[model samples]
Target chain A: MPPLPVITGLGFITSIGQDRATVGRSLRELQHGFERVEFFGNPNLPVKVAGTIKGFDFPTPSWRDWRWPDRFTVDRELLRGLAPHGVYALCALQQALTEAGLEPGELGDGTTGLFCASAGSPFMLGSFLGQMRETRGERGNPMGVVSSIAGTLNFNLATHYRITGAVCGFVSACASSSHALGYAMDEIRLGRQQRMLVVGAEDMTDESIMAFSSLRALSNNPDPATASRPFDRRRDGFVGTGGAVALIVEDAALARRRGAHIIAELIGWGQAGDGHSVTASHPEGAGLREAMRRSLADARVNARDVGYVNAHATSTVAGDRSEALALHATFTSQGARPRVSSTKALTGHGLSLAGVMEAAFCALAIDEGFIPGAAHLEEPDPVCTGLDLPRTSLAEAPGLVLNNSSGFGGSNVCHLLRRPA
Target chain B: MKTSAPSPTASTEHEQSIRHLPAPARAAFEQFQAGGDPATLDPVVLAILADFSPRASEIPLADLPGDTMLIDDLGFDSLAITEVVFAAEDLFRINITNEEIVQVRTLDHLRGFIRAKVAGRSAR
Candidate 1:
């Protein structure tokens, strides 16, 4: 309904790394984060590997107010201190404020809002389920009980930042953060707020692994090095990964006048729901096509203007094929196709964090002028022949990039990004 | 809270009795065995529930008391209670109501609720 706000600053933590430079270096070197299961229980399960964040340390009692920090310990512990979705949002907001040379108290209390996306039910529920199984017929510890809900984490973040504006969590599965980003952009553009912090975060849990494994939707490769081969013919399935990514979105005019280092412009965002089955995608990629087409139209850019696509290919059988079909349809309609790549091969599907991870990738790509290729893509699926998927390494400079995140419940979202002049 | 009249089916009764699970009471055992026997309650599920209400594991089967607080005594918070209810429903293949959950706080009360609902459902 309104023009999208510009992204002023960004912060992200993934299996790859915790900061932009570190993650970028890893991406350039084609380093991966997947590894064999070790710490978590039942390592002998069919899906025994994941992209786990190693040796992360969150701020402790000595660093921050113990009471304030304890409230978010549930998420912090889950992430090993990489910052939960809400903490990530706060860090990104702070970075943007600092870059814009604004003070922590500058925006006032009620003017700043927080919108975040996450597969809310999974992490907490899965943990609770696991606990329930372990202590059958036994009463649970109160501390563990309160810490496992989706809302608690969001509330903790809002409380910690003392944000008084609208604070809400979106649970549209994988589209969670994308939807949150879109909402925050609209809020700023429509004058709901001059600034908003949007974030996406997820915690990898054994239940998540089991669920994906049950659906046969994960790569079973034991070698963490080559596990997440997106778009590769031998790609088994997506490797589950976890992390948080945050972006500070603000009104472009305000940012310009303030001399903020505007990283990229959030030209447009489009979201569509297929009303399809809970887990299965529509055969023709109807919802995905509409989302992309609408995003492009909203950005007032032609198909040819799009230089790269960050695909939502989780390497699942149905998901990969369906996304490919959708891309083929979108590009073919305009008589040209953009080079496509899947960062999931690098970061694993961050679930709720996938969109933000890809968004960060887009921002970095635009700034650096090179698009990162989908790692481990040796052979392409015959059904995906129509798409121009990059395989070898980072190649062409990207002027504009599109990040796609299609989730369960048939929710599809697309964000279009353009390099800042 | 207003308690709904108990249903007449076996499954419905089981679903309705979740709220009355007392400290250390076994709420979802029968249901957990619905798809044949599971050999044991899933360890992960047990661990999560125990974390929610430690007394759930601390209370002995012989010492199960009717008046113990699910939250205060057994540690079943709002979220934990919700999970327990869902787990029972999944195990028993029955849909439960929030009202029913609200009324359950003791082991006997939960058993009665499930017994009534299961009987009511079977009558149909």
Candidate 2:
């Protein structure tokens, strides 16, 4: 409605690297995080590779003191006793708040809202399912059912952060966080809240692994180095990765007054549904084209102003074709095409976390003046032959960047970002 | 072929009013089944499962064959099994007791259990 809010600070955790510098270096080098995991019971599932996070130590010691109940046991045994999405959201929020130099009480009571996008159910589901299967002959624990619901994560995150403002969770499949960011930006732009915390968190689980494997939508190229090759002709599918990202967005005037380091401005956002199939995207990329056009229109910027585009190309056979066609059509119609690149090749598909993680990358790209090329792309798809996908590195100073996320069920979102003058 | 036994009904009639779930709710249901194992399951289901299994790494779901004993075949201790049960109950919005859990040995059984709970709730 009003002028969109500005992103003051950003934080993300992914398999490629944790901090910005480390992740930035990996992206610049085009490093891949895929590797074979023997823990999955199926030795013949074809896709043995994944972009897994290693050596992450949780800061909360209280989790260790808690009782190892049925659900807790699942967390401990399967997830290595890590905190759920709610807890991760809180932790990421804390970091974003700290980066923005805001105290716990600074945002004032009931003025600070929490908005998040999550693709996975809480980590408790697998443990409960395993328990249900094992305890089939006995009475199951009552707490397991309660702890495993999807909404519980949002509720817990709000309570843990002591956020009194509106609390909403957006679940648009892979576009979950992108939509959440767009919504949060709109809320702040309309003067509903002084500050908003937007988060995208995911917890990869077994059901997710098998589901992708069954569809052959995962890269089976055992070598972690070459597993996720987005835009590459030999690309098989995406590497399922996990992580959380948090961004603190506030009014540009308010942030500058407080001397906060303004990273980028969220000028426009567009959301659309394909009304297409539930799993695959439309071949012509009609939904994606509309979303991008709408975003540019909302930003009041011409297509020529866009410096780079962060694509949602997950390296799938159908998905890549659809996205490429969409980009070509959109840019051709405007007579000005921007350089397009897919980061999923490096980070794998983070699902709900992808939008925010890539948003963080966009912010970094604007600041760093370089758009990382698609990681293992030796040859672009023939369908995308006409598109100007950056195979080699490009170091153009970006004035504006657009991030695209297309999810299952025809959900698509595009966010237009501008470098702060 | 004998049809599988139907699931238990929901406790309240008021909860049965809504039959079709919006995209988010359906997504949550699919996610519940793919818990903690994204590599094997469908991406849609994996997206849902990721919600609950944040720390879930790559584990093959095929190893968890329908006929495989949850404890013996899967090498899951009591705690792991309980987590899976909790996920099912939460996603399906049904109350599955320890006794009901004991009857679920395979993926098919788990799906049936959830369907029965939903059906029962709708019947009310």
Candidate 3:
């Protein structure tokens, strides 16, 4: 059997934080990263809040005008065909590679591969497509296809990094990055590649984010603090957010030989789908429950040994209920209680990025010796009544951590992680 | 993405393969791309080329006269050409067809193309 894949390097660019130290501090202090703003600048839109990303400039959705923190030096050529989210992903990748002591531009020896997930740059698509339509379909930006589609990340990132290994784009919506991570693990475990870079990013634009409001899945509450109260009875809906997160999933044996500091071991992962509904999960959280059980069984660890669970409860009424029911059936009702919380209560739901971002949080918790607690859970829902939803950070190192991530197509993926031995 | 060249290597090789043509074509391209005052290129057209040609900002836009190589002398890829065309269209309020974009190898070609379009529109 192959050694488990370990997370050696992590790079984060999220609403809550952008680095290990800042992210650790934010999670530890329960700092809520939210802001009230009229998406689309249209007063008629219902939702007025989001977990807005800070310290980035987006005067226009165009990548040319978009500027992240000046600390990272990026070539102008690389930005030509990118969207805002692509830039974020690249910036996050820089951080990850640096932490892993991997040199950029030299990672193309075929040992390193890249997998990326993003909802795509809808705002940039709107801009480019708008131009095409206005021009009567004659001509538009040449990079329209590579910069806007769901697979944009694969094309741009793979070509940029020049990875010769398996490069794929996962599009399971919110569960996209989890699928990427899972496949990356298989690639490393199968000895196909020494390491794999998994990146997930999303555009924080009216076209990209407010489009979800059409489904009424976004919080209508104007108050940023209480807008994303996952697992709470008063929770209205998930608050949307965007940015990028990245992880370097390396082979444990390779990492150990190279003396790389492993943050967490991705012991096992499992994925299942809810065949019942197109958008909603199984009413009883059947798919999620199965995913958790499969993950535990795959990891060959007792369910009772799992110390922390990063719940996928996104604060939506039905979504939270579904996840809570799944949690109860999987752990609580089985007499094995685990500390559970939805970090979404602070960071908001980052859609496709949720999987990798939450998983990275688990890695941070293990590395920083703190478990992030649910931020604004004043009142628990009836389904989550027996669940332990700590409303603040737990100042203890977690033994076994499970991160749950689900998507619109009823796709579900769960990962089991633990502190490196 | 569509670029002026089907491929950068192919375009560069194609231009260089023609021993005599590449120098003149490159000269014309360099003059216009370098923002040099080529008598055939209008100052406005030269400015647009200079601005969009990746690193041609240091080239004097409306001063020198002479052409330079066209393909792969610098890193101006196909996407940059599309951007140049888009900017030229918006600035001159003229629509340039793919055929016209393909014919423009040097800054002189671009000047001729845009000058004719702007002149034709004014005459109309």
Candidate whose TM-score is highest: 3
List lDDT for all candidates, in order: 0.68, 0.69, 0.81
**Where in model 3 is the C-alpha error above 4 Å?**
B1-41, B55-67, B93-100, B106-124
TM-score of chain B of each: 0.52, 0.48, 0.58
Chain B in candidate 2 has what TM-score?
Answer: 0.48
Candidate with the greatest lDDT versus the true structure: 3
lDDT value for model 3: 0.81
Q: What stretches of model 2 exceed 4 Å from their correct place?
A: A1-3, A57-83, A86-88, A129-147, B1-124
iRMSD for each candidate structure, in the order shown: 12.9, 8.5, 8.5
Q: Estimate each model's TM-score.
A: 0.69, 0.71, 0.89
First chain TM-score, candidate 1? 0.86
* Worst 10-residue lDDT window, candidate 1 chain A: A59-68
lDDT of 1 at A4: 50
Ranking by TM-score: 3, 2, 1
Q: Can you write out model 1's per-residue Cα lDDT over A232-303, one digit (the tens) per residue? A: 778888899776777878888777878887888889989898888899888888899899999998889988
* Candidate 3 global Cα RMSD: 7.3
Clash counts for the predictions, in order: 60, 71, 12
Candidate 2 lDDT by residue in tens digits, B44-119:
2223333333244356443344564545544555455554555444434456676777777655555555556766
